[model samples]
Target chain A: MQIQSISLSDSLILTLLTLVIYQSAAWAQQKSKFIWLNPLLVTIIVLIPFLLLSKIPYANYRLSTHFLNALLEPAIVALGYPLYLQLQHIKRNWKLLVAILVLGVILVVTLSFSLTMLLIHQKEIAIALSLKSVTTPVGIIITEQLQGDSSITPFAIIIAGFAGGLLGPSWLRFLKIRSDIAAGLSIGAASHVIGSMIISKDNPYQGAYSSVALIICAVLTAFIMPLLMPILSVFFA
Target chain B: MKDIIYTVLTITLCLVLGKLINFSVSGLPASLYGMIIYCLLLQLGLVKPIKVHKTNQWAIKHMGVCFIPAAVGVINHFELIQNHGLTIIGIIFFTTFALLTFVAVLAEKYLANKSESSPSTSNC
Candidate 1:
């Protein structure tokens, strides 16, 4: 048991060490278009494989990195600062934000699930896939309620956020979609918090909007997903 | 040191307020409640944004890294990913981009039209 605890602490050190090194590398290489080298992605890539190859079960890894995970809550809660910074924008454009969120949630959930059902023909999997764009905690709850596999959720949310963060800005730029509000809303809807964080790096204004959209989309999905599941099951179940 | 302590205490207070609200309405996520409470405190001048500014900025920028543990927890579903990874990737990819495109265009158009209609209404 003592040896086990030591290894666990070692893993914690390894996780932090990896995070700091990767973050510093990303900082050093900041001018490159190295999206995959994002600190979060790098940490996951380096540490997960290391854990697996090193025979450190994810349980131990998670426990070791619990401090980092715990920080997620406070980090998220602190988002209100930026959201508050854009208070005037939110106040004036709330109607537009709400409309985008409502429409985005409905269409994204319906369109994605329909496409997934057509391709995979698995109702549970399709439902979970539909909730992929929302934040993780809310996604887990909705997945549990809808009887979808929670395991599929982390994969879905992360990949969606990564893809959205990757594609969202380029598409907006290519399409000449210059509205910060629009850019932020889309990123938040498609990518959740991670996408917002990425966009925030370049555009704090849009990042501010993204945080608002992230919250709105999450709340809307939590309420709407369960209702849609029964209807979706009719065709796909 | 002072900034860290104040920010932590303020966030804790906001979280405690979230807990209080969640007690009455159990279904709501506490993080959202905490955010709303903090936003209100800022809006009402109950808390100075500068007091929490430095720490909050760090938290927001590094928020993605904080989610890594949860994301990497996907390892538990290795077989699922191995079997259906492509499908999952494709769905998240196409659907997210499609939604992003739709919102981006629609929102830009809406904001452009609104500004043209009444520039006075928009503060920024």
Candidate 2:
């Protein structure tokens, strides 16, 4: 028992060291080809292999990082400051912002799920995929409400964010979509927190609008998505 | 001191309202409830803005750490990704492009009409 406890302690310390090392490396190499990936991306890449190699159960790693997750609430509250700064612009365009964001949310969620179901033919998986574009917390809630299989939402949100960050701006450029507000808000809204973070780095105004739009749409979708699920389920068939 | 106190109070109220709404609505998520209430309170001036201090700025600066738990979550479901990776990636790509296109067009039309009608703030 003593030896096992010592080994666990050693592994735990090593995991923390690994996390810190990779995180700093990712940050330092921010200008390199590694720029395409963020710290979380780096951590995940390192972690998955470590977990698989050591055969450490994920629940253990999650237990170690649970404190970090608690930070999301305060982080979201901090977003209020930026939103406060941009309140004037948001107010001026409130109607258009609402319409566009809601339409974008509905269209993106609906179409993505439909396509997945047609392609994958798995009802539970499709339900999980539908909430992917929303923020992770809200996606988890929506997936639970819909009784989806438990594992899909988080992965879905991550992929959704990565996709949005990589393709969103290029798509806009391709189509000559020049309105920063619209481009940012739509990508952020569709991708949620991941996309919001990407926008924050590239353009503050787009980041601000997108962050607000994403949060608003996420809340709106949570309340509304469940209502449509039963009806929408028919289409999946 | 005053700013910290006020910020704490506001967040406490926000969380309390969130929990209350969660209890009240069996169907809705608590975070959404808290966020919507927070937005409404701010909009209505019911929750007056507290001045941001250095500590607040620091907290905001490192807010990305909050997602570590969620990021760590990806580790739990390795098998799913190994199997459905391509489909998931495809969905993210197509949905993002399609939605971005739609929003950009709508925004352009909206901005154009607003500029033409208002006759002021044309620089935007």
Candidate 1 per-residue lDDT, tens place, A1-237, comes to 122554666766867765785587568557675655656556667777877898877776667777776675566567677657655455666687678778888899998889988987777778788988887656755675677766577668878988888678988899998777778778888898678767877877777667667766876787677677678778865
Evaluated on the second chain alone, the candidates' TM-scores are: 0.82, 0.74
> Which of the CAPRI classes, incorrect, acceptable, medium or high, describes model 1?
acceptable
DockQ of 1: 0.44
lDDT of 2 by residue, A106-188 (tens): 78778877888887777777777887777665676567667785456766777778777767778778778776666666777
Error of 2 at A82 (Å): 4.4
Off by over 4 Å in 1: A1-11, A14-18, A25-33, A114-128, A134-158, A161-184, A192-237, B116-124
Root-mean-square deviation per candidate: 4.9, 5.2
Candidate 2 chain A: minimum summed lDDT over ten consecutive residues — where?
Answer: A1-10
